[model samples]
Target chain A: MRSVSQKATPDASRRSETARRAILTAALDLVGRVGYAKLTIEGIATAAGVGKQTIYRWWPSKGSILFDAFLSLTTDQQDGALPDTGDLAADLKLVLRATVDELQDPGFDLPMRALHTEIVHDPVLAADYATRLDEPMRELKRDRLRAAQRAGQMSEDVDLDVAVDLLFGPILNRWVQRTGPLTHEYVDLVVDTALRGLKP
Target chain B: MRSVSQKATPDASRRSETARRAILTAALDLVGRVGYAKLTIEGIATAAGVGKQTIYRWWPSKGSILFDAFLSLTTDQQDGALPDTGDLAADLKLVLRATVDELQDPGFDLPMRALHTEIVHDPVLAADYATRLDEPMRELKRDRLRAAQRAGQMSEDVDLDVAVDLLFGPILNRWVQRTGPLTHEYVDLVVDTALRGLKP
Candidate 1:
């Protein structure tokens, strides 16, 4: 069993990439319009103008496809890479403000919410999402906090794991609950408050 | 158009209260068994040994009934009131630990997740849940923060609303995302870290 990368020629690889992008776009659009409960693999295949077998060849299930689609949508953005401005407060504020913008964007909001709702309802999906998406994003934030600690901006004793949660959790809570507007001011406050605690 | 309170004699009021508790119990049980998407008022009424109109008389919709059922499940516990031990750190740690316990309880977990899923998918329900449940919970935490500020344990300049989010948001995020264990040590770290930021 040869790997796809090993077996494919350059032209074949390019075409597969195009097909992948189209499939993801269709999946996101359908999930946004019909929601997670209503979305189906056949619907995504029809929307993408791909055969059902093509989707199955690439993805094991609709959930995995939707998860990959979410990752694709987010990867082009900051995708959890924090700015290393050497000013901890300024860097956090910049990253979090961008997050507020992403959370509020109409294109990202509904599909993301649909995915989150499915995760909440299904334990297997929830664990898979945690491993595939949540953990990677958290590790990126943790790396930044570790850098701050090395710079002597943050205390050496501050737990990077807990600190990452402190930094991103409020922003996520607001997004999930839709408790209030996800504004720049709100992110600024979250950064300021959490950083003050982490500062040496 | 008489209110239930106005129409009820003492015996009738006691019987009505019993019926109300039964309905809520049935709603929670059914939601836990079949999930929110499959749960219905008719199923709950049958399970609770009441007529369908009995449920309709009290709740405007299944979502409203589920919301109330969640409130009933939680109200007997902390109910958002932080322990005012006068030591801000101790008070916060105690409150958050209780929250971790609540989040992990199998009895409360599935039904609460179901209600949360509904809120995520429906804008009107999301607003109602925020106003009726999330806001009140935040306010209770805010009031505790205010008291800490007046006592000089926390800075007067700390934005109470933002502070409240910073305090509770990490725990809620963990609960929603299932990112990691909601351990006592985790809550202790969260309380200590956020309090460090808030301290004058």
Candidate 2:
């Protein structure tokens, strides 16, 4: 049986975790509805049923709140990292398929588009997003490509940075521009074409 | 020697043309400075030294005004189209290099980014820009790719739509994300990689 102190501590931690999630959810919902320009920490606090100080303690600004909310929502996928089955094509195809699913979700799409627009116009937000969101994903891709090179599966001469761009650019472009359906077949083709170009 | 009627007609036309250019320049300038959300048609007219009626007569809304302004600034490149030297690699490289130059220009980049942010937020603006700006460019790329396929330089199995995305996506990604310097060598690599993957 757990001691009273131990049970009490975990109960408090769980309650805090729940409050944090509610705050993040409220932030995403408000941003999607009212946009990032109009979103406020007070509004998010009210929506989350938390004291404004609770949010202020965790995040610096409304942008940081939204960024954290976004990061939390995507934490599972990012934490999973890209699969390394020793087959570059299959691994990339799996990751891209998952990405397409994420991008297609209305929950993720609207708030993300709002954040993306803000990032484009605000230099500070752009740098913050790049450091927190983009850099991790990029590093994961580079690591996979480097592993592929070491295994003699991909050309050592390949520029991994450019290779990363070539592999992911089409999907990002389509998502941003709303050019077409981001279907599974499309990612398969993208992976196939890119891998063909990147092979040793 | 010009006839009297021809001389007067061209003089008036030139005057009208000058006014049009001034309006566009003013629109771009204001959007760059104040952003699309804060910008108004009245502000543009005042900056251009024209009446608000003149701007309203030409463009239906502030977004339309900025869109027209952006189109006017890019008209030269659109008119020139992609070079059809019957060499796919060289032609794409030339066009992308020109694109890099245009994107790098502060005159083009700031206002374009402003308009782009607006488009991402507004669905109607997205559709409007797609029809006016994106489709024409896509059609041009498709035509070039088709010609390449006919010339046996590309695989007939290539999906033209996907091919267009793959070819232009990296450049667009770099431009939108400000991820890295879009240089001549970068475009060369993009063209080479895409073409290698695309060949029969």
Candidate 3:
């Protein structure tokens, strides 16, 4: 989608882009410091050195701003594919281990966890989250699994949705619920254990 | 733990128990009606026909009240064991399907989801959640899996924790994220796939 500023003068468009970036950056920084419950639009505006009206014109609420801020970071970091080294287990472990590291990073963890907390309570935000972030990422996972199925590394009869959930669900559940430690060894075991059933 | 009321007269103890029940009931009812965000001590007191001091004397916060209320409901419903029909897959499917239904039930859903939303943000509450609710439930699940191991229905080498997560995680992830329909069929497939593996 083209920006509304596309029809505006070059100088005006550049300024708009600058303000947008600043607001997103400020939202992430402030959320990390103050926590999501205490984060306010006035605080973000003051931190960003922009008018509160500027933020209001673009995003309706702090939740929306945080969504965009976290989404921007994710989009910047991802190259749009789960790594595929032709070994399905190795590829999954590689990606999931990276995820563990990212979630552990203080900079990323607070904002992402904040976004998840918001997603749990708000249905509209959850829909936006599913459409924009989750589905695309899930598709990338499915692509890798599809490749594995074709390579005869996985059963062709396996349902990709269920398989995808099986592959990623334990790690995700732990993160969301804080049920267990997120670790490289944990991801490796999760991958190995999922690929090989409990049945003897 | 014995109630403090155990030291009091039987009439006084009975009165205290009645008030305690009222507060828990009111907490769940109010949360379901107005949501956790808007639930307040004043509101709960009015609904329960008790003074605000009554609620304060017992539970320190709304979160605690909701926790007790939810815990009571769960304990009453559970029989202290996952069914051991001596069929691992069928037993797991039976319990998980019941879980799926409980999550879908209107009376149970709102307060439970409210507790989860709080747990996501509050480390203290998360700890309480893990110790008081999750660990005991997980022990029951592990017991069933251990029975499976002994029966030769499962591999003895499998990590019980990881095995437990594998069987329950997909359904839980789906429910928490609203990522898919929570159907008995979905739970059945998750059990089968996790037990059978994707390896052909």
TM values, all candidates: 0.92, 0.90, 0.85
Error of 2 at B172 (Å): 1.3
Q: Candidate 1 lDDT, tens digit per residue, B77-151?
A: 865577798999988888888888988887788888987788777888889889878887778888898999889
Per-candidate alpha-carbon RMSD to the true structure: 3.7, 3.2, 5.0
Model 2's CAPRI class? medium
Docking class of 1: medium
Question: Candidate 2, residues B30-137: lDDT per residue as tens digits?
Answer: 998888888988899999999998777778888777777777777765673667889999999988998899888888878888887887777777888888888877
Q: Which stretches of candidate 2 lie over 4 Å from their true place?
A: A1-7, B1-8
TM-score of chain A of each: 0.92, 0.91, 0.82
DockQ of 1: 0.76
Whichever of 2 and 3 has more TM-score, that candidate is 2
The order of the candidates by TM-score, greatest first, is 1, 2, 3
In model 2, which residue pairs have backbone atoms overlapping below 3 Å? Answer: none
Residue B19 lDDT (model 3) = 93
Model 1 RMSD in angstroms: 3.7
The DockQ figures for the candidates are 0.76, 0.62, 0.46
Tell how far residue B186 is off in model 3, in angstroms. Answer: 1.5
Instruction: Pick the DockQ winner.
Output: 1
